[model samples]
Each structure stands twice: as C-alpha cells, then as structure tokens.
Target chain A: MADASPIETHAHVLTLAEPLPLDSGRALAPVEIAYQTYGRLNAAKDNAIIVCHALTGDQHLASPHPKTGKPGWWSRVVGPNRPIDTNRFFVICSNVIGSCMGSSGPSSMADDGAPFAMRFPVITIRDMVRAQVALIDHLGIDRLHGIVGGSMGGMQALSWAANFPERCGAVLVLASAPRQSAQNIAFHEVGRQAIMADPEWKGGDYYTADLDDPRKVGPEAGLAVARMAAHITYLSEQGLTQKFGRRLQDRDAKTFGFDADFQVESYLRYQGLAFTDRFDANSYLYITRAMDYFDLAEEHGGRLANAFAGLKTRMCLVSFDTDWLYPTSESRAVAHAVNAAGAPVSFVELSAPFGHDSFLLDVPALDRVIEGFL
Target chain B: MADASPIETHAHVLTLAEPLPLDSGRALAPVEIAYQTYGRLNAAKDNAIIVCHALTGDQHLASPHPKTGKPGWWSRVVGPNRPIDTNRFFVICSNVIGSCMGSSGPSSMADDGAPFAMRFPVITIRDMVRAQVALIDHLGIDRLHGIVGGSMGGMQALSWAANFPERCGAVLVLASAPRQSAQNIAFHEVGRQAIMADPEWKGGDYYTADLDDPRKVGPEAGLAVARMAAHITYLSEQGLTQKFGRRLQDRDAKTFGFDADFQVESYLRYQGLAFTDRFDANSYLYITRAMDYFDLAEEHGGRLANAFAGLKTRMCLVSFDTDWLYPTSESRAVAHAVNAAGAPVSFVELSAPFGHDSFLLDVPALDRVIEGFL
Candidate 1:
C-alpha cells in the first residue's frame, strides 16, 4: 500500500503586488503564495481540508522532501487510512509567506531583482492565514471541510477559524496557543541572536555576497546555536533524560578536555548542522517574528472570545501534558474562548513525554484523537 | 544585625601527593583543596557546618569575593539570623578540586610549572568530598553539625552523607541530585566541545602562548553556547515565557535580517557573556566531568541506601516544582534512600517558578523551611 501511494504532490504558486492591510495598520504588498495539493477536488470542492505547517515547516505536507530525502513532516497523521485521510478528503498545504520554500520570503527577489533579506516586512500569524485565504480563493474553494495543524500550524488553524469562521467546517489545533508567551518568545529571540552574532551571516545578503560572510547570512555557528535551542523545546526533559542521560559519547573517562563527551552533545550538533541544510536563516528570523506577533485577543480588543466571536467551526484542540512550550493551560484558554464564542469545541490533554512534538511522533493516543476527530 | 555579626573567614589550601584509594579502583593524588571558614568552633567542634557551592561557585560562601565585588552566593541563607545562621554554627565552603577558584584545577600549576589545563586528573564528586574530609582533619573537626548545599553543592552534601556518614550531624540538600542525568551531562559535553572547537583555545595552552590560538583556552563562542544551553536547563518553560515571551528586542517587526531582534536574544547574549567573565572555560570542562562521574549509589553496589548506610545525620532535601534540572523525583529518590538507611529525613517540593535556581532566590517558604530545620 505504501508503494502504491506516490510521495510527490503537485504544487502551484500565485503572486500579488497589491498592499495587504495588516492588524497593526501596516500594509504588505507584492506577496507570493506557494502551495501544494493532494488528491483531486470534487465538483463541489466540499471534500477540501487545509493543513498548516508549524514554524520551520513548509508545504509538501504529504510528499518526500526533494533535498532532505525525508518524508513530509505530517505524513504519519495525513496519509491513507491515517487521520486526515487523503482517501476521503482533498488536502492543501501552503508555504507560508515568510518561508524560503518557493514562498515570498527573505530569499525571494524584489522588484530590483535582489533578495529581500532584511527588507522583508515582519508578518504576523493573522497575515499568514490571510495569505492562505487568498490561496483558497485562488483555488476557487469557498469552504474547507477542516483546517488542521500543530504548534505554529495550530496557530494558523485557530486563526482561520477565528478570522473566517464560516469558511472552515472543522478545526484541529494541536499543541498551540492564542498568543506567543514571554518565555516562548524569549527562546526564539535567543535563536535569532545566535544566528546574527555569527560573523559569517553578513547581514542577510549572503546569497549575493561571497557566501563565506558570517555577519550577514552564512553564520553557520549562529544557526547551529539557534537550532540547538529550538531542539530542546521539542522534547520533554524526561524524554531527553531517558534518551541521552549523562552517557558519554566516545570516551569512557572525560579527557578533562573540551570534546563531545556525551551523546546529547553529539545529538544537538547533528540537529544543528542538519537543520542548516534544509532551512534558510532569514526565513527563520521572519517566521519566528510572525509567531511572536501572534496575539488573537490583542487583535480583537483584549478578549480572546471576541476574536472567535461568531465562529461556526467544529474545533478539536489537543494538548500534550509534557509540552512546556504550549502547556495545557494555553489549550484550555482556547477551549474556553471557543466555548464563550458559542462554537462547537472539544479539548483533550494527552499524556505524552515527547513535549510539543508529540503530535508528529508515534503517539497512538494522539493518532486515536486525530482519527476520532477527523 | 547583618554587619555586627561578621564572621572571620580564612582561605587555606591542603595538598596530598600520595595516591588516594577510590571506589573505582583508581588512586589520585597531589590533590589540593582551597577552602574558607566562617564563625568559631564550639568546645567540641561539633558546630561545624560545611556549605558546598554549586557548579562555578567557590569557597567565598559568606565573605566578599576578592576578584568580583559580589558577595558569596549563599549569603542570604548563611549569614547571621539566616537559616543556617553563621553566628551559631561554624560554616565552611570549599572550592572543589576540579574548579578554578583557587583550587587545584586545570588552571593550577602542575609539577612542571605550567597550567595543568587538560592534564588535570579526571576528578569525581566523591574525590571532591574526600579532599574536604582532609580539610576537616586538618581543622581537627571530628564531627560537623551539618552539611548544606544546593545544585552541585547538594551533590557534595549527599556525598558527605554517603562517604562519611558519621561526620555530619545534619545534611540539607537543595536543588540537587545523587547523580547527573544523561541529559544534564549532554549539555556539559556540548559546552566542552564548543570550547575545544574554538580556534583560539590552542589545545588548552592558550595561557602560555603569545599568538591568538583558539585551541589554547579562549573558546568564548563555544563557552557562550554552552552557557546558553545550561541556562535553559536552569529555567522552567513558564519562567522563560513569563520573562521574555514574544517581545522583540528594539523593533516592532522582524528584521528579516540576522540580528538580535528579539528580547530573548539579548537576554541569552547577556547570560552567555556574563558567565565567561566569572568562569574559566577549562574549569567548566573539568567540573562538568566531576558531576557526570558522580554516582553515590554505584559506589555502594547499586544500592543508594547502602551509600548512606548507618548515617546518623538529620537530612532535609528541598526541591522546586519547576526545576527540571534536579526535579522532585530526584529529591524523592534521595529521601527514600536516606529513609531506607534509617536516617531522619525531611523532603519538600516547594512551589516556585524559578526552576533550579529557586534555592538561591528569596523564596520565603524556603527560608522558613530552612530556618525551622536549622
């Protein structure tokens, strides 16, 4: 069955130069939408579901990545017979505006034929959802049977339900929040600084420069630091302890010298180095900003419920107990807001030691939740 | 009242050149100890309470540091009218053998008159405590009223109870564990590797070299990464969220450039740079190894209880709810071990948002607990 199912899906893009009105009264223009679709849309297009990827994630939700040879991040939960089954529903995933995966991001060429780099406008979670909405309109789909995501994806899903309630039939939000908390924002900031501090970064225009410039774009050291920081948030402390507890890497006794002496150290290095290959540093900076700017309530006059005022989607929110990133309280807050908005909502906190990334891992209970919800 | 009851503290050193038998069947010697004492010894010298400092801390427990203007780390809990009142009990804090603060560490001169650096013997927590025992012998203190410490300090306190149960009348451990978990060790390894990877380090001999050799010692970048990694472990996700959230550093939008745009970025930079000023990169390498080698139970045939067999010390173990570093489970394990050994033990998991550093902060409840116990 796996062999029968092709891993590559067709993708398309649309560009616009008109200014987009932002929540902060700023306008974004000349935007480009990069997206992919799986399965065929029926005549009514009622079987359509939109999947939003998290921070650092791109489109290609059900396909093998061209550069990394890894399967699409959500393949486990979005394939045939899995939750959000493609057999019954047509799925659409889009490369967010600030992303580098063929999307209009820092690497995209400006009117002057130069990479946007530091010139790209800061985007918000709502802005990302707006771009998705434009793509749906371009695809001629008036309504989605469901909108699903986790972490940053979860943020987009909630944004769709709250921003265009009538357009979404159901929303599945896993391990997300209504706004970026102070600590969450702090961690992302640390990553950004780490990348910027690298002398090779060269501002953000390493693409046009000698590529070896560390201060602008090619700051591999800083990027590695950022990746290491983010990787820690993806796993629970218990998970980390269980997987790599004080185990030395190559030597029995510490050489009393600076070396990779523990398994966790090696793992973090791999994570950092591997991440740089697939991700663009500038995109990291922009996407993290979008996440940091996300505040559903703040956009709707300080009442989260007001943001979802008149939403008509069936919402299922899932949280992982060990996910310190967007803990159970954040999920509960969303559930409360949805309930207060008089929308249909279901919320559950699952026991998973994988932290915020449990949704992407092999958690049978999470699978069950997604299966039942879908 | 704080100034009037000033204690006379003196810094002294003890060196042993002969081989000292270890549980691991190894003998290490020419070991040196740097320590300080506060207050006066009672008629029987039973009022001596050894205060062990955490990683990067030194012998200046209650007195002012000569190098840095900062007072001793545990001054709040160890001064007059404090929980472990210096007026009533003689307090002694020692710079662990593997550390840099005037102890026999990697930076100390060897027989060849050069900084030991990587040549320093791989030391363990037990070895550190053993050196303390020699110091006690030198001071003619047959028994101590208590042994107090937090984090790594707590490790030494636990070691005291395990290796010389008859020497301590009471033992108070704060924010510590019996052994380093794999995850904890992994962080230290990363730091070590970072230092080693630096071009300026000059293979631990940077101190003697006139040229800018990255390998000799000044792996500032790597050390910074290590500090950043360790700093995260010292904090709870909630604390991070509360402290920095998604706030941008100096702008309202993502720079799309490689810069410290987020407040968290600036915070981490401050944390990393500040750490290097007060710490030695080489000492970080050795001390972390000592922590990783610490296994109280393994020293007693895999039975943690046996490590503290026949102990007469009154034990108090304090844990913070948000501390993933040495979580409550670790403290509970120690309490269970002490209980099995028939020692009088008190265990409490205090509610605090500061994570592992809660013990150092002004948690009134913690003060009350210590005050009541002492």
Candidate 2:
C-alpha cells in the first residue's frame, strides 16, 4: 500500500475529448469524469468492476473523504476481503456527471472558462452512464466483470446493462427502484426549493469564494436545510427512534427555545452543516432533478422490460426490508422486468436496521448477497 | 342552523379573569380562549363535549375556514348526522393555546400590549389542557360527557383525563400517541431550524405587516418550507403514489430546470404557500416544542399506566393503520396501559389510505367507531 502512487488512492479524472449527448436535448463538451480505483485491473481487463454512487456520494469508495477527514462513505463494502473484495476485483467509483466531486458539473469550467452553474444542462442517468462509458473506453477496457450500485447508483448500473449489455457481464443493485416515486420527487422538490430560496444562492452564482461580500457567498444555510430534510428520508422512523429517542442533547430538561433540544435534531443539523463543506448546492439541484426525471419504463415507452430485451447480463436485485425510500416491492418490480426480458436475474429482500442506507452499512446479510452474486 | 346566533356559529373569546398556571412554571394573565359551540348544553351540563384541535387547527371544526373558505378540517366526522352528532351533544372546540387562531399565543398581545414573539413562555400539552379547563369553568360546566380529539387534539384529550379524571366521563383519542418519538421530534426540529435560519425570521420577531419593507416581515419562505416537510408525513406513500405518482404538473415534458415538474411537488408547494397565509411561524415553533415535550409516562413518574391510575373515565382509542406518524402500535400501548389501570377502554386499528390525517378525512369505519364509542 505504501508503494502505491498518491494518484492510486485519490481521484482519477478523465477529460472526455468528445462531446457527451444528454437526455435533455443538449450537448456537454470537454466533460470530465472523476473516478477512483482499488485493486489492479488484470491484463485482460475483464476483472474491472465499476461502482456507481448515490445522490451525494463521490469516488472515495475505500479511502478518506478529502475534505471532511472522515472515512470514505462506502469504506465498509469495498476494501480488502470486504463484500466487493478489492483483493479479487478492480473496483472503480466515479462521481456522477452532475456531482461536485472532481466531475464536470455545474461548478466546473464552461467553454468560456467560467463555472456553468445554473447554465449547465440538466443530466439524466443515461447521460451519466454515457460519460462513464467514455471513461471506460479511454482506459482501454473493452468490458467489465460487473457493475454495482445502490439507490441512484442502481439507476446507473441498470442503465449500463440496457445501453451497453456487453460492457458489464454482471449487475448487482441494492435498495433501488426502477424509477422515482411521486413522494421521491416531492421530497427532492423541497430540497431544491430550499436551495433556490436562499438569497446567498444568487441564482446559482454563489460558487465564488467571495469573502469580501457575504451575499455573494454560497447558499450554505439553504443547502443545509435541504440536506436535513433529505436526511430524514434516508433512515427509518424506528431507527431514528432507537438511536436518539427524544433524548435531550446535553440537558436533562428542555431548553424551551429554538435550539437543538433533541439529539436527533442535533444529528440532523450536523448532517446538514457538514454536507455544505463538501457539496455544491447547484449540483445538488441538478442531480436531484436528474433523479426525479428518471423512469426506465418511460424511456422505453412504458415498457421497463423492453429496456432489457433479451439481455444476456447476469443481474441480482437486492432490497432492504426497512428501506421505505425504495421498498422491497420496487426491487421486485425491477427483477420482474429484467426477468421478463429473459435476463438471468436473482432477487433478494434483505433485512436491515437502516433504511435506504442499509447498503452502505455493516449489513452482513447484504455482504453475503454481494459476495455470492459477484 | 340559520336561526342560531352569530356568537354560537362563530368563535367567542373568554378573557380569563383569573391567572392561568402553565406547565412551564409561568403564569399567564388575561388569558384568552377562543371557542365555538354547536347545539345547547343540557341542564345536567354532563352532555358538554370538549373537542380539542390539532396543531394548525382552530375552533372552526365543522365550519368553513375563515381564511381559505374551505370546509372545516374535521367536518366529515362532526355536524348533525355525523359521528359526534350535534343534535344531542353540546360540542365545544377551542383553539389551543400557543396556536395562532384567536387564542393567546406569540402573535397575541402580551401584558405590555406588544406581541410576545420569542419572548413567550414555552408551553406543554398540560398547559393547553389547563387553559381549556379555565374556558370550561367560565362556561359553568362541572363535568363533561366526553373529551374528543385527533393528533394533537388527542394529546389534549389524554391529558384531560390524566390531569382531571373526574371532569370527563369518556375520552376518545384518535391517531395519537402518549408521547413524541425521536423521529417526531426530529421532523419538528427541521421545521424550527428552517424558520430560524431565515434572516427574515429575525429571531421570531417578524410579526410586522409592513407594506413598505417586505423582507422585514414574517418568515413566509421558512414557514412554507416547514409546512412542505410536515405535509409529507401526513399522507401515506401508497396514497401519494395513487394521487400523484410520477404525474407531470401541467407540462408535456420535464422542464430540465428547478420547476414543479411533478404534480406531487406542485401539490406540496401549494400546501406550503397557502399555509403561510394563516399560520404564524412563532406559534409553529411553540406548539411543536410543546408536542415534543409530551410524554405521558415521563410526566407520570416513568409509567404510562400511572397516567390512567384507577381511572373511572371510559376511554376509546382508535388508530389509523397507515399512520406512520403515530402508528397503531402507539395506540395499542395506550390501550394496554389504560386497561391495566382498570379503566374500561376500547381499542381499534382501522385501515385508511390518508395516513395520520385519516381521522379528519371521510372514513366510514372511523365514523362508526366514534358514533358507537360516544
């Protein structure tokens, strides 16, 4: 590990020299995809595995978060002898097109060398997959052993088999649905409104680190509120109750004011605040919009099965029992669609205390499913 | 009826000549309780039924809302031929203290003739019940036939029996728990944070309706955001899906920007916007804090059964199966404790699509239960 290059543990950015076609009737040029790889790709390149990330995730799958100095968000599932087993597979996790990591997003430089910000075209899961395809091509990888993801990442993984069936031989999806529900869209909408309502956002022109003028700064408060709201959806009510349980924060009695009286409130506030340091608000807007627009069935004209028509890829769908975000029924729908398309698919509904976040947690059952499926 | 006096049809405010003691160890002088009554109280005065309203609800239980011109929030289960038939019962509903309706709240004039704003003392459910008791005393009622309510109203109903067991003969608590859970407190905290974070909130001092300076006024945006978040919890995922599942809002295609692309988003936005017209942000903060502090067991020396100790009040508890906010299990716990305390209590969990608000909606099963219970 010490002999490995600094680049090995950090992000690997691929500048797509070609224009990327988007689902929103627009073209994005000079695109960059930020990715990180663990374990070496075999000479045949057949051992290469790509990992798609969720809404606010980046490419630091098994390394430390560059900004927060915290462990990687998915460090539990993608290291040596772990579920994905970096020792046996070359795992790659890339920050999606509309994300803030090193990827080409709203915060990235435009053709005129200025941040695109709100001017950036809205992207879709398909568009995100296309960029990742270009990255794989640039790396001279003809095909990958597998593609894995949970939540929004599952959308990308599913899209990969539809668009590039031969690129990835296997697909493993966790805690995902075929598309976003009305409740899903509604929650995301609240987050977007929260960001847009902030005066500091300045019509998404708050990317500049303007210390001179506070109004020109980024929409931290709005972004934090957005995160706080979304954070509530990621966990189960039972989990939150078990963890915090109306317990006061460092007090035996209530403060009777607008303070974080409960521990859960303090936890959510901290989640919102810490998120502002590492993510861009505009990017949050764009990526969530992309997710809201995601409907595999609609893309194939109300036929989700048509997306995987006669697919040869081996796929496994996994859902968490506690994941209200994308309940087991959602995964079952995906499995039915893929199975109807004549693809080899296996489905499992695992039990976990965490909700949508079970895929990233220490769920031994999920680890076994992934290990077996891979 | 058309022959009824305007005072009977509308709200009547009673300025308490005596100081009202609160659970927060503070006394409120010149306390006002705005109440509405339907039908006449019998000579025995035992037929007087006190109906408690939830947070954001007022005394207009079966009448049209003053601002929205919409039917009363719980009109489906009230009125002449309804569950709690007005032909027999002298139904009375008072706007809870710490609420913005005609009651004495943060928006109401303090002793100094200025709004209390954030200076208002923190209130609890017991505090609300105490105010109601004073109102009942003013009306010359000794004993009530029943105390009925849903959600926060249910909290008040339960508190009435616990605090003044001999004052009421029967208690009907619908879709409510004896206390707030961590998830409940967490959701509330998000709303409070949203309101406080808005610079326009000005530490809850944004009560001025200044036409010259709009920004110096109330925290509309923050309050709207709070409502949007809270509104989601009021409906079930299945219901939201059935009502507005992936349906676009007056558009042929996605706008590719931050707009209400989905009907659910539009619906939520409308709910948030319309809520700002009638609700005060400071009252929302105070009431939510009171709700969070509600723990019957904690107040009864860490045993819920103690709240109903040797209770003579016949109680009926009903829960909506779809209500994740206050699930059926919560009601079951209450029933168990009351039964253990030798109180004649009936418990039923009814199926409803609307989640926590099912008690307010047109559910025939609930109507029957209410009718039979009373």
Candidate 3:
C-alpha cells in the first residue's frame, strides 16, 4: 500500500441562514455548527458516515482535545483498522448545538453581541438531528452509509432513522434508550440544580467577565459535584467494587476526616476537576435538559413503534450487559419495535464490566460486532 | 389492653462516669445516652428487646417526631397490635452516638462547654452496640429476648451477636450488609464532599454560630445536596418511575430554565431541605466514615465466618429484592458465614420495590417474618 495522507481533521462551521425552530416553540437564529471530517468520500458519495458523541463529548472524534491535550474521546473506534475505520468509510462528527466546544451554545454571542447564556432556546434530540441534516445538505451528500452513536449519541442515531430515514442507509446504536427514563431525568435534575446552586454561576453571566481573572470564576465546585453524581450512574456496583473496593487512597488507614479517603473518591474528584477545565457549566445544564426532554414516542404520537413504521434503514443495536443507565432491556425494546416494523435489524448484548461506558472502552467483542455490521 | 397506658414515652438519659472506649483508641468521657422504652420489663427481664434505628433515625421509634410532626418512623410495624407488638415486648430505642437527635453527639456540649463538632471521635457500628450494652446494664437487663434493627440498625444487631453473644437471645437483621460495599462508600463520599464544599460549613464549626438566633445560617445548601444524593440510592429506579415519571411540578410545559419542572426534582429538593432541619452535617461525615471502615472480617483475622464461629445467638436475616443499596447478595453472604459456623440462622429475601428503605416502608410480608422470628 502507498503512503496515506497523515490523519487530519477538516473543520467546518455552517452558518445556517434560516431560523432553527425548537421544540420549546422558541426559534434560534443564524445557527453555526462546528464539525470535523475524516477520510475520502467515494465518487458516488455512498460511503460517508455520521458519528454522534455522548453527553460532555464534542466533535474532536479522532483528534486531540484542544484544551486537555488528551486523545479524542472515541479515537479507539474511529482510527485505521478500527470498528468505524476511517479508510473504509468517510466519517463526520459535529459538536451538538447546546455544547460549549466550538458550537452555537450558551456562550456563543447572540444578535446583540452578548452571550445567549440562559436566553438560549431549549433544544431537543430532533432539533440536533435537524441541524445535522442541514450540515449534510450543505455538504451535498445524497445519502449516508450509516449513523452511529452510543449513550446520548445513540439517541441521536435513533432519532435520525425515525425522523429522516432516507438520509442514512443504516443505523448502529449502542448503550442508549429511545426515551429518557424517570431515573434518568432525576439524575439530570440533580446535576442542573448543582450548577445553578453555585454562587459563581452569577445567573450564567460569568462568561461575560474575563475568565483568566482570578476574582471572577464560573461555578467549578457545583459543576464538579454534578459530574461526580452523574459519573456514579454510568457504572455498575460490581464494576466499582472490582475497580476500587474500599481501598484507601495513598494512605495506610482512614483519616476519619471529610477528605477523599478512598481511591474511588479521589478518582471521581480528579474526573470532576479535570472536566471543569474544558467544559462550561451552563452548557452542561442545557444539554442535559435537552436529553431529559427526548422521547421518541412523545415526538411520534405516543407510540415508539410508530417511529419505526415502514423504516427501510438497516439497523444494528448493541448494548452492554452491565450498563444500568441504558440496560440491555432497552435495546431489546427497540429491537422488538423495529422487528414489528419489518425493518432489517441486528441486535446483540455485549458482556462488558465497564458499564454504560463500555461503548467507549476497549471491548474487543464490540469491535468484531461493529466490523461485521458495517 | 388497659387503655394502652396513655401511649406514654418512657425517656431516659444514662450518665456513665467511666470513659467510654472507642474503636479509634480514643475514649469519650462521661458518656450520656438518650433513649426511650415501651412496655414494662418483665419480672425476669427476659422480654426486653432492643430496637436499633438506622442512620439519621433517632430514639423516637414509636413516638411522634417532634420537629417534622410526622408519625414515628416505624409506627406501622412497632405499635401495640403490630408485628414487634409493644404490648408483648419491651422495646428500647436509643439515638446513636455521633447523631444530632437527643443523644450526645457533635452538637452536644463538651466538658469545656462547646459542641464537640469535629472533636467527637469517629465511631463504628460495634461502638454503638457497646453504648447500648451500657444502657442495658443501667436498666438491669440480662439475657435479652431479642435485638432487632434495619439498615445501620441491622449492622448493630449483627455486631452484638458477634462481639457479645450472651447479651441477647435472638438477632434480627434487615436490609443491611456485614460490611459496607464499595458502591455504598462511594455514594457516602459524594455526600461528604457536597457538605464540605459549602463555605458556610466553616470546617465543622458551623454549630458554634447563632443557630438559634437565625441572624446567620449553617451549611444548609451543602447538607441538602448531600441528602438529595443519598435519597436517590434509598429508592429503586422503578419506585421513582412509579412515584413520579416525567410529570411537571406545577405547569403544563417545561420551564426551559433551572427551575424544578419535574415532580421528582421538587420531591428531592424538599427531602434535602427538610433533612437540614433535623440533621448535623459533621455527624453525617463521621457516621458515613465509620460505616466505610466497617469490615467484619477485619475484626476476626480476615475471616468473615470467624465472626460467627460457635455463636449462640439465633439469627434471622432479611433482605429486600429491590434494595440495591444492600441487595440480597449481601444477606446471602452473611447467611453463608453464619451457617458455616453452625449458628442457628434463617434467611429470606423479601420482595419490595422500595429499595434500601423497604425495611422502614410498608411491607406486610416483612412484618410476618419479624413476628415469627421474634
């Protein structure tokens, strides 16, 4: 094989001229999208794939994070010879609208040159898919090879098949649900309350001030607490036990103080603190609220099967056995609905101890499944 | 029934001149225990039964909670004609050490005329049982009829049999583990962080401020967050869905802001705020730490079975099917150890959708089991 082009990210920011209508009945104007593309599109444009990211994730699918310098969130699944191989299929990933990283979000300046902040229109999964469809239209792509995602990303992939079936040839969803469960909404509510409870939040106007100035800061503590609480739900009790079972963190015995005495606590603190460095608290609130309001059935006349009626898109659904957040039962529900719709579907529940995050983790079994499905 | 003796509350405060030894090699001098007793101690003192309360629970077992004006927490199962049957058994319940209610705790005055606060030595479940043993001695009780408890209270019951086997004739433990699980400790760590993160916590010195004057406040926000996080674990995900599923609090549509639009959010916020009125934040830290440090095997040469070797206490261990906090596996582990030690042990996993708090909630099947065991 000849030497290939060095892996590079092709960035695009589409300034949609039309107002984007939202589920909340408010309209967002002049929408700008930040997206990255990898690999080459075939002459027929039949090999282009759309990749979606989970909550707290951005468009840097296979590139280094600009702020944290960490490898791309899904680098494992999108690189050469990987499940979603760059060479086999062209890939496009975009930062969701409500996110902070290079997307039109709460921090983006509005019509009057002031940050939207709390004034940003409430978005839904269908809205996010609509924005993506606009970007796809702008690229002049007739159709997509597949739409792939896990967790919240999986929700978007499902929404695409339900809302615009002709846009994609196949849908591959992992560790996701068609609707937000009551427990799911409750956790998100706690996270939002934590962000708003912070005095530094300043009603989401902290972005107007100079962030470098020590005197003015965003709600880092509140955001960190929110991250910590949400992180627990993403893992299983068995996984936590095996990972950090009552093990002291760099100590011979318990300190009996309020400090992080266990390894799990220390790890959660690091994850939370590291997150605040690259994420905006307000963005966290909007995106989670969007997720809470996502219900495929509610959007389709209170019937999940109605969304799948006469669906021609080939679909592959995979769920992790340990993922309590979006358990295998959820995957089964989707499989049952689509099967009744007479859609060609392949479903598998992969065994992985990493819980809901197994989709992003190094599960070789998942790689085989995805490779075969593609 | 002799008119039920006017439903009196026989309260006592045992003042011991001797220094109460603790697990941390520290001692509490002139220990005082606040407790309440129901029914009369039989002529032989053989009908005396000790009822241990869970964490955040106090001595008002069958009596009205003065602050919240709610009926006694276990009034459903411990009344005259109920399962525990106060008319037949003398039940004694004490507010645990390190608790804020009535007992000598972080809020109690020290010898130097200041609240103990952080100065209070961290205690263990075994230590709480030791204090109760002193109270039993003060009441001139010997060879007690039974020792019953649920959750943390259940931990105390198990410790009594393991440490002082001759003190009670029977042991009834419910919805608890012999050792706190890794997931349990992780959740507790989140709560501690939430409490300490509040600026008003003042490093556990918030109690010295004008709590009565109301000119200033303590860490109510932090404590509320802590309570909210912990409360989620007490109920099953299904229970939450059944109670409140995507229902708006008081409006027809979403608020599109940080307000609690969902019913679950409002309920969680109320639970957290109400908790701050009757609980101490510092005590939350200490008791959770004590629980995290608990390991029955560590006290018996790293052999859990050794904790029950040659035991004389008859035991009945009950677990709730839906209680993920202390699941059926934990109860099974304890049963296996006791059975191996030739202890007369009976174990059952009851069905309840209420999760960890099912032992305190309405479950008539549990009442039958407890009655038969007693």
Can you give the lDDT of residue A373 in candidate 3?
84
> What is the per-candidate TM-score for chain B?
0.92, 0.95, 0.97
How are the candidates ranked when ordered by lDDT, highest leading?
2, 3, 1
lDDT of 2 by residue, B197-225 (tens): 78888887877654235442588888899
lDDT of 1 by residue, A56-104 (tens): 8888788888769898887877766667777778889999988988878
Lowest summed lDDT window (length 10), candidate 2 chain B:
B1-10
Clashes of each: 39, 0, 0
What TM-scores result for chain A when each predicted structure is judged separately against the true chain A? 0.94, 0.95, 0.96
Stretches of candidate 1 exceeding 4 Å from the true structure: A1-4, A17-30, A208-217, A242-262, B1-4, B13-32, B189-217, B237-268, B371-374
Candidate 3: the clashing residue pairs are: none
Which candidate order results from sorting by DockQ in descending order? 2, 3, 1
**Candidates 1 and 2, the one with greater TM-score:** 2
Q: Tell me the interface RMSD of model 3, in angstroms.
A: 1.4
Name the fnat for model 3: 0.58
* Per-residue alpha-carbon lDDT of candidate 1 for residues B1-374, written as tens digits (9 for 90 to 100): 23547667777877765655554455655577888888778988888888888887889887887777788777877877777787788888889887878778777777787778777777788888888888888889998888888999999999989888888878899999988886676566556655665555667765753323534247676677678767877888778767776577888866544456667767877888888776788888878878877878877898999988879869999999999889999999999998998989999999999999899887889989887877
Estimate candidate 3's alpha-carbon lDDT, on a 0 to 1 scale.
Answer: 0.85
Worst-scoring 10-residue span by lDDT in model 1 chain B:
B208-217
**Distance (Å) between predicted and true CA of A286, model 3?**
0.8
TM-score of decoy 2:
0.96
The digit string of per-residue lDDT tens for model 3 on B230-256 reads 899899988998999878899987776
